[model samples]
Target: MRILVFGGNSLLARAFTASAPSGAEVRIAGHAEIDAPELLDGVDVVVNFARHPDDMRLPYDPARDVDRRLAKRVSPLTARYVMLSSRKAYAASAQWDATEDSALCGQDVYGANKVASEAAIRRLLPADRLTVLRIGNVIGPERIPGRRSFMGFMLNTLADTGEIVFDMSPFVSRDFVTVEHVAAQLGRIVELGLTGTYNLSSGTGIMCGELALAVIRGHGKGQLRIIDPRHADAFRLDVSRLVRETGLRQTADEIISYCYNLGRALG
Candidate 1:
């Protein structure tokens, strides 16, 4: 199979390329490189991982940009489209795990952007030709602990200073998936020509404090300091579809271990 991936420089893209089937012909390109019509020729599948809804600068509207790209660069081409969406697109529901059928009433700008993009793709392509993957927080070897990202902040602080000081309670939870798992599942989905929306996650939630402790344990040392005693509610994704279809399962501990190892390697 001939696959074309956008956002080639992204960590997930790199992971996907690395984990792709051995015999599959994969091509990686940035937005600039694949903007032309000729680049779409002979492509069997197009996996888009590049677009960000955060760029609200002039002449770069997220919804409009996705529509324009699809209308001009992708729609005319004969390739299946796989869009990488975020779990943030689901409205906040503390009582239940968000599923594919959940309401797409995301109030945040980023989530709204994904909703818009998904709508546009639905309109532009037939259901059989489109596949949307609503992915959770991806943990991978490429992560670097820093203030910019939550995992980074926790892991980096603990690894570097041997202590983690969190302003919020440690009870906050989120679904985290490993990049390797996502890449492998995506490869299989493409190979099987599966369509429709699927939630890609670890099918479980992990507490922030627990995650910190796991990372520390994995590192063989560190401390967790929580300044706030108030607990935060947890949010999880209903990955039954992915599990039923792809048989992919991962625990929060597994993800934490992966992150810790990556941090150790980086250090």
Candidate 2:
């Protein structure tokens, strides 16, 4: 299978390129190549990992329409399109795991933008030729420090001061899938010719505290401290569809070990 990829420098793009299956042939497209329709010639699929800046404060900004424009450019091509969406597109739900059919009532600006972006792309490409993957928190060897990347921030703190601090209670949970696993799943989706929206995740929740502790264990000396004792909502994705279709899933222990291993690698 021949593939063309955008956002070639992103973590997902790098992971997919490095971990693609044996039969897959991947090509990273340059900025100029995106405008060239011939770039999609003989390409079986086009996976876009590019992100758009969405600011509700600036509602009329044209810069926020990057995805829509790319959809328009690639719509005429024969290759199927794969879009990487986020789990944040769903409204906060504590009663049940969010499914592909769940209401897209996410309240944040980023979520709202994703909802709009998905709709816009769907309008351009027919359902049979489009695949949207709503992914969860992805973990890898990110070492940057800041709120922009949570794992990176935690690791940086541990490296600098041997401490990992949390503003919310450590028990707060979120679904996390390793970068390598995400890449492998994408290969599965492409190879199987799966279409429509699917939740790509670990199918379980890992507590923030547990992950921090694992990281500390990997770092060999860091400690976890929680500044707030208030409860925070835990969110997980229902991966029944993905598993039934691809025979792929992740256990909680595997998720914990992925974090632990990341800590060891980055420490």
Candidate 3:
């Protein structure tokens, strides 16, 4: 199989390339090449991880729908199109996990954009030729602890002052999956020619406090403190479909271990 990946610089793209099947030929296209029609020639599948140039810009503009534009261009050239949607596409329903059939009720701008992109892609291609993956938090070495990301803020604070503070309780939970797992599952999905919407996740939730503790323990120091005992905006994805189809599953323990090892490796 010949696969072409856009947003080649993205962390997920790197992970996918690293673990791509041996029989598959993978080519990466940066922002410049994404617009080149020739890049789509001879590509069996095209995975898009690219973000619109206007993403997160203060004055939001719907006209800058890059995902839709990319889809329109690539759908005609490639046999299969895989879009990386986010769990943010779903609203925080504290009651239950989100399944592929769940409503796209998220109010966040980012999530709304993903929802729009998904709709546009679905309109452009049939179910057999398209795959939409509503992925959860992916943990990996994409960002160093001291960088400007969520993991960076937590670990940096711990490293600098030996204390990690959170506005929510430690029990505030969310789903997290390893980059390796995502890469592997994506490989399987592509090889099997599976299409349709799927929630790509570990099917479990991990507490925020527990995550901090694990990283702290791995670093061999640091502490955790929750300032607010308020309700947690927790969410989880129902990955039964993914598991039934791909035989992929993950545990909280494994998620914690992955974070711990990441912390240790950062030192």
Candidate 4:
């Protein structure tokens, strides 16, 4: 079976493709060509990971545009379109864990755009054939703990410097997932030909302090200066819908350990 994977160069896309069967037939389409439905002609699945043109930052903007282009290519196409969206859409702008049926409120640019993009895709394909994965923050072997992806960045910095300060409140309640798990589920989704909105997450979350200490313990180094930042709102995704449908669950500790080992290898 041949599949067309847009966002050819994204890290997440790379993980998905690399984890596919060794002999799977896959074609990568550049973001520049996504609007041309011919890019995926004769394809069975189109996994879009593009960024919006407006995103100028090195990685974030480019990824945002990939999805932007994806929203454009849905019509007149007959392939299965699976979009990777974010958990930000339901955040309370502070802290919240929302079920799939919650009243969605898109706050950030990333969240707002994903909400818009999902709307566009659903308009073209019914919820049955079109899949929108509202995903958690993803971590991998190369995750640099001190970089600006917020949590990862801060932790890495503290590890490097041996000491760092950060404001922590009632510990944000967001989950982090691993790419490997996501890839496995993506394959299953294709096998079943099922489509619908689902939350793909770690199934549990770590408080800010817990996440920080985990980094320190996993590396056997660093001192975290936990500051008292007011209770920042966070979003917890209820992935039970996905669990019931796909039978996917995750142990946060295992995923966190994977991050540590991957970081060790990179270093």
Candidate 4 residues 1-267, lDDT tens each? 676778778667887888764556888887577567477668777787776645332323424555545645655666777888777766454225667776665656666666666766676675655888888877665445334565456455755676546675636656777778888777677666768888888768766566666666666666667668776646567778888877878887786676556434433
Total backbone clashes of candidate 4, pairs 3 or more residues apart or in separate chains: 21
Give per-residue CA lDDT, model 1, range 136-249, as digits (tens): 877665436344566767766766688888877888877878888899899888888889999888878877777667667767777888788776545688889878887778
User: What C-alpha lDDT does candidate 2 achieve relative to the native structure?
Assistant: 0.80
Q: Give the winner by lDDT: 2 or 4.
A: 2
The residue-level lDDT of candidate 4 at 85 comes to 79
RMSD of 3: 2.2
Estimate the TM-score of every prediction.
Answer: 0.88, 0.92, 0.91, 0.83
Better of 1 and 4 by lDDT: 1
Instruction: Estimate the Cα RMSD of every predicted model relative to the unseen true structure.
Output: 2.8, 2.2, 2.2, 3.8
Across residues 136-195, which tens digit of lDDT does each residue of candidate 3 receive?
A: 878776445446555767777777778788888888788889888999999889888899
Q: What is the C-alpha lDDT of each candidate?
A: 0.75, 0.80, 0.80, 0.67
Q: In every candidate, how many clashes are there?
A: 2, 0, 0, 21
| Cα-based lDDT at residue 92, candidate 4 | 57
Candidate 3 at 219: error in angstroms?
Answer: 0.2
Candidate 2 C-alpha lDDT tens digits along 197-266: 9999997888889988998888778789888887765678888888888898888899788778878876
Compared with the true structure, model 3 gives a TM-score of 0.91
- The residue pairs that clash in candidate 1, if any, are 145-152, 146-152
